[model samples]
Target: MPPEVIERDYGCGDPSKYLRAGETVLDLGSGTGKICFIAAQVVGPTGRVIGVDMTDEMLKVARTNAPVVAERIGYANVEFRKGRIQDLALDLVKLDEELQVRPITNAALFVQADGVAQKLRLKHPLVGDESVDVVVSNCVLNLVEPKSKRQLFGEIFRVLRKGGRAVISDIVSDEEVPEDLQNDPELWSGCISGALTEEGFLRSFNDAGFYGIQILKRDEKPWQTVEGIEFRSVTVEAFKGKQGPCFERNQAVIYRGPFKAIAATYAGEGNITQGGINMGSVSKVSHRALTEAFDEPLTRAQVMAIVSPFIRRATSTPA
Candidate 1:
């Protein structure tokens, strides 16, 4: 792989520290296998790292790098599968259509020119329910269509073992955005405009049945801004366990010492503040930058600040 591939690529944050050796790890939107390769090293020979990507170009790059990386690291424990974050399944429907084959009566009967069926092991979304030890993502969740974002988190929670963890880094907005901004596909794909407000982000995890969702690290750098809009990157860590929601449960709290937070200025005349419950600074981040400032859940003041505008717009809906 070219050095630029590793250097030029943008992401929310590094999510590898939370991983452990001999543990199965899944990387959502695993672009170019950057996180996957790092994760493969952490898991060692006994463990596995699965990279899931919606873009074929990215998967191609990741798949191409797999063998070389494995050779260099001396471990063939990493694999990449192509699929959307919301639909992590192998997408048999697409595969069948691409190969111009009818649906197979049984999984065993399915076959492709490249043996995609066998390659993907037909496990799809592949982690299997309650089968994975950890799930890591970098700046990919914001790209998912809003309608499927909830299901994405639900799937992550479903795939995790009882005490598994979901560590994510993505761009997030300080407040709800105007409709024109949200509709802009450029902003959407670039990781801006459609970002979940901090409250909504944490709420989505809670709604998906995750416990102990905390922000382990964050940066206050706002990557881009237009007009009055601003964005930042965040690294969020949430666990699947007996504990309750981080924000709702009084005891749940964030551990801020693992990663250092550096303050960066926001654009277009705005100020961001961290909430009482969170351990990092709250700053407006672009969609691409959302994954960088992954800290504790937003504070009550922060939550209200992030949600109130959207609520007003929602209630103002015309009947």
Candidate 2:
């Protein structure tokens, strides 16, 4: 879906590329069904796509476009549930008669509209634990309050089947988010106030039982700058398994044998020292190289070359 159709398209990249056919995928914080609609194409008819959004207005727009989009592609596998990402309780029934919706109680999939900051109280008449194959989120997780972010991850863990993966793209800060900046309403709505430091963000996933987390891609451009707070757009991949992340972690596995160097070598006052070197302000090195070099990026060859040697160890056991 285009940004013009729905203005809140702040995603870093399309995550549906990683989804497999015939797998059930869930989109948390799904806004206007942009990614959900796109995911429907990839998953096919046999697969399912459930889009959960808290905003009624957004859900209205999403539902309006869902039929058209699905008809255009000839599949009705995509669905939008009106509920919060953190607390999915659209199927719950209260003892009193006032708190009931006939359609929600009867539907196969029901989602509630509640803020992720609160604890989720879900009744499993609809979706259940360990039921989904993949969970995808785009540009919305950062807006969630810090206290309930863990529960949000736990909810993802609870819904995912074994070997399920989460592909998400969000805004991440390079440094700690100051309390004052975090509390700013403008920043909060703009997707910066609730931003997590890159390390802290990954740790949250690990703490919630996700393993083998790795960055698929990272953008050099800063998306939003509020009160001098800068952030990056990163697409991350994590698995709900006991094994280590597919990408390298802290472990420094040496390249057992010398192979090849594709790029021309640069020699100056300061330059990257070839294998697995992180050169940046953090490294305190000023090399006469491309701006991309200072970014510590992986060239096509370099990214492929490191696959054999890198070994990642889980920093903590799953909770």
Model 2 quality (TM-score): 0.66
- lDDT by residue for model 1 (166-214), tens: 8999887778777888899888878986688777888888788665567
Q: What would the TM-scores of all predictions be?
A: 0.67, 0.66
Model 2: per-residue Cα lDDT over 170-284, one tens digit each: 8899888999988899889878889998888888887887755788878887876666767988888877753322332442211122333222122112223335432221122
- Give each model's whole-structure lDDT: 0.71, 0.69
Model 2, CA-based lDDT: 0.69
Candidate 1 lowest-lDDT run of ten:
278-287
